[model samples]
Target: MQGLARGIVVLGVMLAGVQAAHAQPIKSPQDQACRDEARARVFSTPDPQGVGPYVIGRQIYMACMQRASHRASVPHRRAAKRVKRAKRAKHR
Candidate 1:
C-alpha cells in the first residue's frame, strides 16, 4: 500500500511537471475569448453511452484549451520583439 501510494504521488508530480512545461500562459483578451469558445465546444457534445463520453470530452477539452492558449499568445509575441529592439537600442 505504501509503495502504491508513493507511485501515485510520483506519477502525479510528473504529470504536473509535464503540464507546466507544455502549458502556454494565456495573457491576451483574444486568447481568453478562444479559451471560452473552446470550453463551450468541449462541453457541447453529448456523452455517448458506453463509449465513455466523459473521457473523450476531457481529451477534446484539453486540445481546445491548448489551441486557445496558443491563439492568445500571438499578441504577446510583439512584447518579445519590443524587448529585442530595446536591447539593441541600449547597445547602440
Candidate 2:
C-alpha cells in the first residue's frame, strides 16, 4: 500500500514537470536575433547634458526640497501648516 502511494506521488510530480516544460517553448533563432537587436537599440543612445547654470541651480533646489520634504518631521509639518495659514491671511 505504501509503495503504491509513493508511486502515485512520483507519477504526479513527473506529470507536473512535463506540463511545465511544455508551457514554455524554446525560442527560435529568428526570435533570439530580434530580441538581441531590440536590446542593442535600446542602449545605443547617450544621455544629454544639462543646458546652463540657472537650469542646473533650479534642478538642485528642487532635489533639495524633495529630500527635505521626505525627511521632514512632525515639527516641519506644523511649520508648513503655519506658513500656509500665514499666506492665506495675507490674501484676506
Candidate 3:
C-alpha cells in the first residue's frame, strides 16, 4: 500500500539519521589535549631517513587522532568486546 511504503521510507530516513549521528566521533577536552600533545611531540622529533616532514607529520596526526578517539570510546569498546566474547563462548 502507498501508506505502508511511506512509513517504511520515513523509518529508513530516521534510522539513517541516527546512524550518522553515532558515526561522528565525540571528542572530549582530554582527547583534545592528548592530540595537541601528540602534535607537539611529533613536530619536535626529526623525520625518518627517507620520508618528508609533511608525510611524517600527517602520519603522526592520524595516529594521534585514532588514539584520542579510541580513548574517548573506551566504554563503548569494552561493551562491544564483552558482547563479542559472550557470543563466541555461546557458540562453542
Best by TM-score: 1
Please give the CA lDDT of all the candidate structures: 0.73, 0.60, 0.74
Off by over 4 Å in 2: 25-92
The clash number for model 2 is 0
Model 2 residue pairs with clashes: none
On lDDT, the leading prediction is 3
Give stretches of model 1 more than 4 Å off: 45-92
lDDT of 2 by residue, 20-87 (tens): 98554535554444344444443343425736543454454445455555665336677789999999
Candidate 1: residue 61 Cα off by (Å): 10
Model 1 C-alpha lDDT per residue in residues 1-92, reported as the tens digit of each score: 99999999999999999989966788777656655665666556676664564465556656766877677667777788999999999999
Of 2 and 3, which scores higher on lDDT? Answer: 3
Clashes of each: 0, 0, 0
lDDT of 3 at 72: 69
TM-score result, candidate 3? 0.37
